[model samples]
Target: MHELGIVFSAIDTLEEVGREGSLSSISSVTLELGEVSGVVDSYLLDCWRWAADRSDLLRGSELLIKAAPAVSVCDACGRTYPTVEHGRVCPYCQSADTELLTGRQIEILEVVAT
Candidate 1:
């Protein structure tokens, strides 16, 4: 799936960072994942394990993911609500003018070098 591609991209980024910092090997990587990012954790981990093991700099490295909740703001009501619960609709005012505030992220937070 696309998780493999994402893993490859992450590996590339890690390699670049390692080169910049003169790191020989990485121990772990922490990622902040959003609820609406459409990335499956199990799939991403599986991909990471497979891809990381192939890279000398990333072999045996750990991939840690933190889930971020999805939030939406309603323009009509000027209020925020959980996106998973109410979607684009504003629960308070029953309006459809809403915008997603979060939950579409898949960012690397930290990388630990060994």
Candidate 2:
């Protein structure tokens, strides 16, 4: 699945970073995942364990993910609302000009290394 692919990508990046930083070993990898990023955290983690085991650089690495809350800004009345509702129209002014403020990102934040 795509989760496996994503995990591999993260592991590859972590390995490269570890080498660039002169790290002896990677202990953990922290990721920031948006609620609306369309990724399942648990699934990604499960895939990570499998894929990481295949790599010496990431064999013992821990994957830590932080879920980011969903938020949206309305263009009509300059109001913001929770994007968890998943509505195209703004709840405040009922306008369709709402833009997403956050919760659509998948990023690697930090790496814990020895």
Q: Which candidate number would show the highest TM-score if scored against the true structure?
A: 1
Off by more than 4 A, model 1? none
Ten contiguous residues minimizing lDDT sum, candidate 1: 1-10
lDDT of 2 at 101: 95
What is the per-residue lDDT of model 1 for residues 7-42, given as tens digits with 9 covering 90 to 100?
A: 899899999999999999999999999999899999
After superposing candidate 2 on the true structure, give the runs of residues whose Cα lies further than 4 Å from its correct spot: none
Residue 89 of candidate 1: its Cα lDDT?
Answer: 88
TM, every model: 0.95, 0.91
lDDT of each: 0.94, 0.86
Please tell me which predicted candidate would have the highest lDDT against the true structure. Answer: 1
Clash list (residue pairs), candidate 2: none
**TM-score between model 1 and native:** 0.95
